[model samples]
Target: MNKPNKAPNNKEFPLTRETWRYIKRRQKELDDAFLSKAKWLPNDNARLSALLIERGELINEFPETFKWWKHKADDRARIIDEYIDLLHFLAGMDGMPAALFTMDGGYSRIMFEAETDKWRRLSNDYVLEQLLDYSPNREYPVQSACKVVALATHIMGRLGFTDGDILVAYDAKNAENFKRIAEGY
Candidate 1:
């Protein structure tokens, strides 16, 4: 829905919540295309694998800050890319609908469901800090990856990523994903 032909306007999407709605609309295309079976449940092994793969990709962008003078912000874009990649890893699990606004107190915590029609919250940051870290609590299924996506939006806010950037980038990725699925990628 981003209009790249015109000037960038963060106000177009305005809030993280609005951006999420946009994301979910596009995500449904993938869910429908890929998991069109009765009880289209997300596989635990697949989720964990995707999570770790994305997390490792994020880590690979790390550069040792041997000295304060040696630090570079150029990787900011790469970091954000990796963060979004992490969110995409959890995109397809059934749970609560996306929120109309950003989630509060989401720092270091992951939101998921542990039972039918039930929502439970947990944090993935603790496990992420460990090397070869992986969390296998499929019971703590990501009710909706939008929560995790919101966490990425929060990070983007910190790195000066405006609503426009997120909205545009997300739409762009969504289209690319659709193409990949169409091609059986």
Candidate 2:
């Protein structure tokens, strides 16, 4: 139940340990890839802008009866149509699991059992008390709570908790490794 009016304050959502660790891991991977690449492509920002503009126009002209138009109609017409137009391409939408937070529609499948339980156990009063305690600075608590929810979900899912529904499936070799470690004397 986040306030829909404003984006949460960044200070209130300062990165948690798991979130920071994930960011570091991603940075290391990016550095490794950059060092390994034998060739680099020149920046294509201008071409991308032109393409975006062209697609934006086409998307606006799409039949108003199009399926996606209904969901996005409340937003600025041009921006919503422009984004949906971009989603029309495979390269634009594929292979991006991490950038899903740009819009609510992008969440793949949110299994909220764990999230709901966490919130229930933590209690709204406790959260509000924390917000009040920090209120001298007027910091909102919603952002940090959201980040905690996300990181808890990721860490629990990664560790094979959360009913295994959100967990990534493992291959046979990894399954055997799990058994060996779990059964250690």
Candidate 3:
């Protein structure tokens, strides 16, 4: 069977529902196969904390003005890295199905606003934990997991991330992680 090509970027938004679903599915599969395989409470807590921290770092990338002397890391790449890390934690949860997330507007508002975004990220972590806590004790914490995935996708959009950037960055990071693992790092 042949599949038709997708239309190019929307210029305004970087994601599509189908693409978002695919990325989430891919992340879930990879996490299930690797990161979540030997789950631990400490690791879960680390993921949650890392996500909150990433959100904070991501905000820093947008400075009020750029200094000619201040050579900084690529902000876009940094955001993507943090975003993927957050996805990894969400993936580790292993709860949510891909269908729960999409590129549309139903997210909990994570725009360019600093104050609101910070608070939102905090609230999100709280909600994620609550979801996992209420879920039945099992290998996959489905309830909290899916909600997190949905929220993360929304965050991607709010952070001005694109589907192309995610696809590329994710592959690169995944490959690097594998290589590092193979090298016993």
Candidate 4:
């Protein structure tokens, strides 16, 4: 469990291969349960659309990330929740490699570094290009999905969340999702 008073520290819950594996496995379980309840087949296009929408929602949580004049205080808890919400959709996408989360000096760097608004804008634009303009025929869905995850992870880091923090939030959200399904949500 995450201690709310503690500062974000990637070293506390390092991104080991086992930890990445557990996250992937748990996400798959949640996806299976969600799909089973809805009786809906997975569609790549729809998932892509949903991922894009969730990305927008996550972006909405950080007005300070964009609006230079607005000096609102950071809402760490809400930001973490929205990040996990984005992860829920990301897990459903096919071919997202564990290396993106586990590898050294690659995607993991983006997840650990503090992002400036310029870099964030560039990353967001890159994701939009990959998802919207680059792959109309969906020929490279995995690549596009990878970019989306990269952007999401970068944003999470920007919000000062560690990989371990994400796992805790994901666990909590997964249970909430299960409960929602049980209640016919």
- Using lDDT as the measure, the top candidate is 4
Candidate 3 least-lDDT 10 residues: 103-112
lDDT of 4: 0.57
Query: Model 4, residue 137: what's the lDDT?
Result: 31
Per-residue alpha-carbon lDDT of candidate 2 for residues 88-153, written as tens digits (9 for 90 to 100): 221122223333332222221222333334434553334333322321111312222233333333
Off by over 4 Å in 4: 1-17, 68-71, 95-137
Clash number for every model? 1, 0, 1, 0
lDDT of 3 by residue, 79-128 (tens): 67766665555544434243233322222232212223343544434433
lDDT of each: 0.47, 0.30, 0.47, 0.57
The candidate that wins on TM-score is 4
Stretches > 4 Å off in candidate 3: 1-7, 36-46, 65-74, 96-161
Q: Estimate candidate 1's RMSD in Å.
A: 8.6
Q: Model 1, 111-163: lDDT tens per residue?
A: 21221112113222322233223344444435233343433343344346676
User: Model 1: which residue pairs collide?
Assistant: 110-122
Q: RMSD of each candidate?
A: 8.6, 18.4, 8.8, 6.6
Over 12-82, each residue of candidate 4 has an lDDT whose tens digit, in order, gives 22333344455566777777778786766767667766776766666666656544577896577877787
The TM-score values for the models, in the order shown, are 0.56, 0.19, 0.51, 0.67
lDDT of 1 at 106: 31
